[model samples]
Target: MKKTKLLLISLLLTDFVMLLQPENAWAGDVQITCDLRVLELTSQQRNQIRLRRQQYKTRQRQMNENLMNQNVTDRQLSLRHFFSKSAFDNQQADEIAKQRYANDVRQTVAELNFYHDIFQLLDNRQREIWLQQCVQPAGRI
Candidate 1:
């Protein structure tokens, strides 16, 4: 009986640890073929792309911070609702969903603009290289 109990406890601990592992841990064999450095950018083009990339990164960071804060606020509100007798606010939920959608749109536009700027900076040969090395293999239609 003691041996059976220990085995069961060990199984439970193993399951718990498996649950905490990231889903991407299973993707160790996946490889990326796109190499941005193959562009062989000139100094001026490199500087321009760097500036645009930095701006895009800053925007993304800001969006992530805003999203984290919003999630915290939502979690707190949910806890309060769970303890209270008040009904759930469907209208407020709708507003939050709208805001999230807007944020997604804004992020997508920023990403598109950043890529467009980088593409514009690339020469004809570089553009072809980017398309072949980065875009085509990624299954871009």
Candidate 2:
């Protein structure tokens, strides 16, 4: 009985440790970018990707700032004190959706441009590596 209890406790502890381990799923741009390590990029290519990523981040920040400014204007126009909480939430959601929809095309163009720049930098072998090891495995290709 003691041996059985000890074996069960050990199995439970092993299971708990496994549960704490990080998952393999790379879900975001940042995680996908990290997976670029598998591409074996040259110094020049890495530098180019770094610069492109910086530019992308800057554009995204600017776009977000514009959206925020528009949201501020929208909030200023809405009389928050008059509406019930649910009504205020609905109005805020609508405004957010409008802002996102308005910027969707620009954001997509920027992102596609960024990826295109990165893709253009790769040679055939590197491109295959990128596609198979980085993009395909990430379920992004």
Candidate 3:
């Protein structure tokens, strides 16, 4: 009786642990499919973008994990709450404002660099067609 009860408890614990695993734990194949669909690239273009996209995805995943870890940190959570409350004095407010401006500038620079590379890859005609296809209303197509 004792051995049977121990086995049942162990099985239940194993099942519970499996349930707690992330949904994306088995997402490798699905991610590839999603990337293909979202990028809508030819095979050559896919090959060119694959490494960069993989790196970006890896960085994004790490950032998300870092955010999750931060959420579990009491000090970090308190700081976030404080910021949300807008309780900063003028000096702190100015520092926050400057940091936000710098972040925006960095993001814009990165976007422009990406566009520059993409533009280099496409000729003018291809660029015009791509812009029309992407930007035009669906019904007009």
Candidate 4:
């Protein structure tokens, strides 16, 4: 009787542990998304927010692409490759690229700031939702 009771208790404990495990049936399809559900926003305001978010993402992509392209060009220019034209022009090309890269950085920071300002409008509850969404890991496309 004692052994049987121990076995039953162990089985129940194992079942409880299994039940506590989180479900991920949807796995990659699961998105912890948050929208402007808490706020009263007009259609135009919603559209504007959507547009700004899109533009902000575009700026991030641009920043990454710009840096990568600049790196490739700098490497080629250092080696005086044909794509880099002449060794004489390499220095000027590098400086111009640096200036343009700085401008892109500034623009991206400005856009980020604009989004931050928008976030400031949220009440505590809305802010909590927004922060939760922000902290979530980026999902696979």
Order the candidates by TM-score, highest first — what do you get? 2, 1, 3, 4
Candidate 3 collision pairs: none
**Best-performing candidate as measured by TM-score:** 2
The deviation in Å at residue 96 for candidate 2 is 10
RMSD of each: 7.8, 9.8, 14.0, 16.4
Candidate 3, 32-64: lDDT as tens digits: 112233335567766666665566557556655
List where candidate 4 sits over 4 angstroms from the true fold.
Answer: 1-34, 38-94, 134-141
* Clash pairs (backbone) in predicted model 1: none
Give TM-scores for every candidate, taking all chains together and pairing residue i with residue i.
0.51, 0.53, 0.39, 0.36
Q: Clash totals for all models, in order?
A: 0, 0, 0, 0
| Better candidate by TM-score, 2 or 3 | 2
Which candidate model has the greater lDDT, 1 or 4? 1
lDDT of 3 at 44: 75
Please say which candidate is ahead in TM-score: 3 or 4.
Answer: 3
> lDDT value for candidate 2?
0.70
In the range 37-70, model 4's lDDT, one tens digit per residue, is 6555557667777877787778778867766666
